[model samples]
Target chain A: MFPLSPILSPKGQGGGLRILTHVLALSPLAVLAWDFARGDLGANPIREVQFRTGKYTLVLLVLTLSCTPLSMLPGLKWVARFRRSLGLYAFAYAGLHFLNFIGLDYGFNLRLLREDIFEKRYAFVGLAAFLSLLPLAVTSGSGWARRLGKKREQLHRLIYLAAILTIVHFAWQDKAKTVEPLVYGGVVAGLLLVRVVGWVRRAARGTGSQTSSKEP
Target chain B: MDKIRSSEITPEHIYLGRRQFLVGAGALTASLVFLGGCRRLSELAPTPEADFCGSATAGATSDELGDPLSACDAATHYNNFYEFSLEKDDVAELARGFKTSPWTVQVGGLVNKPKTFDVDDLRRNFPPEERVYRMRCVEAWSVVVPWLGFPLAKLLKEVEPTSKAKYVRFESLHDPKQMPGQKDRSFQWPYIEGLRLDEAMHDLTLLATGMYGKPMPPQNGAPIRLVVPWKYGFKNIKSIVKIDLVEEMPTSLWTAFAPQEYGFYANVNPDVSHPRWSQSSERRLGERARRETIPFNGYAEKVARLYEGMDLRTSY
Candidate 1:
């Protein structure tokens, strides 16, 4: 049982929800900026920023994935409409996380960055995840999706791979405290399982109907 | 990596009292704002002499090193005392009210003169001396701390290790009730660490009692801890209660947990990378730029000779 608030309803004002989404998405960045200015980012500010941005990126991606499952409920198809915006926000945070690593931490030191990419498992997987999100973000517009047709769906399915890589990146980066990353991995696995189960049920039903028609 | 902030000393007890008062009032939200303001204000305010140790000498050795000492707030609050908590930032809060008094360190095993000295007696006898050193964490972060203590060599000499002793094993106090982190069975309790007898006798290896010219905070290994400047931070075991001079190499908590990742000799070597991450460079506390990690953490001239002819790559 879920709350039937206006935001969850099909008849809700799209403009209000869009504004709420943007405000919610931008608030973390604003808080980080404020903390940076006030010198409240603790001992290692660059690290604090990297951790926050990376965490939010995974969180937003999880929310974006959940939209598909939520939309299957009666009168909750409106949730699907927010998927693009949520996904783009996740992509934006991922970009910030990458920038923090390169610009702030590395000071655009190309050699060091290159070495990390090659030598470190976490760095390689993180870069791969971000690269996978890049194409999805670029072609997120409705125009490109329409032009590409079913191919667009196939391309966007890379989110699953991106999600898995992102979790691995996070889990590996932590020296200790595995629980937080493990929780994220579990959620992603559960969301993907829902989609797989739904697809399997539909395929079974379709085959059953085809066999029945052939018999008639 | 050493710099003295003699003028910047803020006693831990006074600060803890202030924090407790704010918490008592249930003004945690207001306290956050207060702390933010105090960060700027504390710098301008001159602090009084610490009451912990009378005639506590200032940092003469570290003043010439030139590397700015990390903020006392950061050095104390950000700790890897897994006995308290796994989270570095959370250790301070979690270790509050941890009893460090009435502490006795048992020095025995292969020592000719096995002795169990009360911590206070040891402190008084050795006298707190300031030795600021660069502490490089295995996680690739570092801090320069003005630790107040005498060398481990002095203590070991007093006990007089026998010819049979090859390695020195150190153990921390293990009370699961006081240290809630010990309740988690995933981690080994009563944190254990070891050093080769020679390494333990190195002049830089300190039996630290305090830092920033005050008594050590409970979070930062109150009463006493180890400070091995050349080795990674984990090797510098905290809140130590037992020191046994043994023949065999002791299995340290980290080494036992992941032997491949954390080797017995966790010396700071730029060439030797951790299994998961590079140790080539490290981010110093409060600085954005990364500094190249040198062999033996820049104490190579003094310590490189200790590891002569040994292949660092394989050993690491």
Candidate 2:
């Protein structure tokens, strides 16, 4: 049998890191729950919650993308371990964001939801990002990883597309080119550039090794 | 199915029954608390005065105008898009720090009398009278606020503008240390707004310093703000610093940023829609209630004459 324990096994000694990640992930939800209980949702609670969750989702998604680049730094080797959890947290927030939009904003009216997805450019981008993540989330389990074999990594590449769509959704929704969206766009670009450069270097190394072995 | 059958009742049903009981108890407790809170608040709140400004002469009545509750509700919620804070609620909170005392307004540009008048001096000279009017915001929300202020025409008359002056431009306060939004370059600081000479001189147009009962809340533009009933809320610039009687059409913040989205006139016409969103309907403050927007925010009879022979669609 192929050795799968390294990827599947939970970190035995570094359990504190896992706990910290869980705490950070739950902090937003806890605040939301408290706000709801206190009835401090403000004038437009639906819009407020939707905007907050969406912004955090984008922030966490950017953080997830930054993990590899961050891990490259000598002091930040542990950052790579949190990448999967961060991505999952981002997906969870994105799910809540979509649910809030549908439940509170649209009241689960399928027709209005369909119309928004089709007619509104920002809605279309948001819907695309949500849909792109669905497959990645479903295939996240190790069972599915084993079933998909080599294709698991290829399917996960859709995250880059989802991030781009999310940033576009934010940009289009903003009436003015404000600082928030511009900063998000810049960070996302930097993260994607790092990924692209890393991929190219890996491909070049593989090609060089194959040619050298073939010549011998 | 037969194998699963048992003589004892399932624990799931018992758990569900307990859950239902707890939910019922919780709801009852909530209502009791809510009622008690409401009673406490009502006790604390000052009784609604018959006349907010005591300036209402004989024959001036609340019913003669309309419902006061509706007017008060409209005044508070629908506001200009002054994103001074990350959260919308922050506007009211942050504005409390603003110092409105010893405020002065500068009047210049093509006007014969170019001078700065203290806010108290302006108030003492002008002497505000209450005017009940509808306020419509570009965001498709509106309210009928009872504004207490002097007429804009009265102020304009004091500062005699030359015949060449066809437009009047208003600038808002621009100190970034105070107005945090000014620190960012998203919009030009000292937010500029303007009106045509005729519109500025209309008797209905007001330079408001107070609303509801007391002096204007800082967030609602304490000291002074314009109230052009016919136009959208943004046209009514707040915390005004300078008033320039100009000859040319001044570049408004909203118009300069997105001309297609916000027009120069920005009249509150239900027929003329914003480029991004529909303006046909408006949500009145409180729970899920909405009303159709009216032409000139239902003041068409009084103000529509000004826009006669002009296309509202194009102007909007």
Candidate 3:
């Protein structure tokens, strides 16, 4: 019988899948850079960058959350190995989105940015969401996860809150067409509820595992 | 918030055949009043020549008070044509294949003589004039453009609206083959907008057939469109197919979709904000810096009287 290698090295050459993942993850930035150079970002380039990066971050974050459920299925435990990488990419995209706003909108004017952080409720919410993701990104290393034990899992649960806040920030900005944001919010809400339903059932069974489904 | 594009980030015309610069306004007269004394509703008159009319000539905008007009590319590309698409740039692509000819605007409902005139005949009947007006959107972005068309009041007069007609509703073409976005069913098809009777008769109100001295681009609402400069951009309904003069106030596309956000009048008021966002400030298309939006887009002197005695905060 062929042995199942559960812990796939997301960055290692041991599996060709890691190379594919790396290429796929970083290709969006390359395409964006090409588009920017080609002047294909349309009339409002800054907005295009900000919107695309934000959307990419949301998509990757959703993907990271989906990994746990997929890994729980038999013979698919290897999907969990990509969660940290997906999360790290989501954080990277989020950083790009925020930086686009700061550099383009405020031109690094700290006073203006501070005023915005106070005046713009969406900006405040965005800052909170980013700050929440910062620690998760920093401690994404497997060694740190091992040291903190279960506390690390609790800290990462803040991601769901961050996702909701991010959608709120997005929805608030969309004044004209709201259905798009509402659709995104609904998707995230459904993902969170799915996780909670499983969590509750486990708690009811007296095996209340706080960590992810494939915690090992 | 305003955005500054880096020197490296220049705009390239993604769509082919997009006009870059505005053509000079040669044959346009910015006459303020189309109808003067001794004028009946059915009476039609050719455009009064400046040399012949002498003192009776309607005063036109001779001097400009504000900045230069927005570039043709920016005005054409950055549009909010929901029928074609939602995103500004996508509309330019989606509407490129649209056919704009053989168009007729049907003027009916509570009118003395209901008529359907081809868009060409309408343009010829009322001599096209030039109007450089600042268009402010509810989204807080603005643009100043040279729109070429005649007063909308002229067309409303030709139809001879009955006294019972208190409102004028404008409807856009709803074919999905021409406008791909209609397939989504997100918004009610056949986008409709309306203006009060007096507001429709205002000289500033125009049946814009063209912009930048050229025929209106399909993406920017070709054939025929309305332009109420003092109101929000959405009030300037595009690709209009029907003009109905109704007794009661008619519901519009934006207001019907979201009543709290889009009011019926939609007159530009810096004091009255959209529920979700502030209308106090606007970012000009070319200039990225945010500027304080003026009351009625700085034409309060002409339009403020229309909203007299009404609470702007509540009405909005």
State candidate 1's DockQ.
Answer: 0.20
lDDT against the true structure, per candidate, is: 0.81, 0.72, 0.75
lDDT of 1 at B300: 88
lDDT of 3 by residue, B73-166 (tens): 6787788998876788667656775788899889999999999999999888888888888899987788888888999999988899998999
Per-residue alpha-carbon lDDT of model 2 for A1-216, expressed as tens digits?
114423444544334445545666666677677666655555555655777788768877876787778777654565566678878988998999998877766667675556556766787888899999889889988899789976887788788899999998998777666677778788888988987887777777777465432100
Candidate 3, after superposition: displacement of residue B299 in Å?
1.6
Error of 2 at B243 (Å): 2.6
Q: What is the full ranking by TM-score, best candidate first?
A: 1, 3, 2
Task: List model 3 lDDT by residue over A1-216, tens digit each.
Answer: 012212454333224444445556676777678677866665666777887788777767776777777667665566676678888988999999999878775467675567567666877898898999999998889899899877898799888988888888888777555586787788788878877887777776655554444343
Those runs of model 1 whose alpha carbons end farther than 4 Å from true positions after fitting are A1-12, A204-216, B1-65
Tens-digit per-residue lDDT, B1-316, candidate 1: 7786966776865654453443234223422422332232233332232132243434643433577787677787678888887767668767878899999999999988999989999899999888889999988899988899989999999999999999999999999999998888877878999999999999989999988778888888988999999889999998999999999999999988888788888999888767565588889888879988878988888898889999988887
Best by DockQ: 1
lDDT of 3 at B75: 80
Better of 1 and 3 by TM-score: 1
* TM-score-superior candidate, 2 or 3: 3
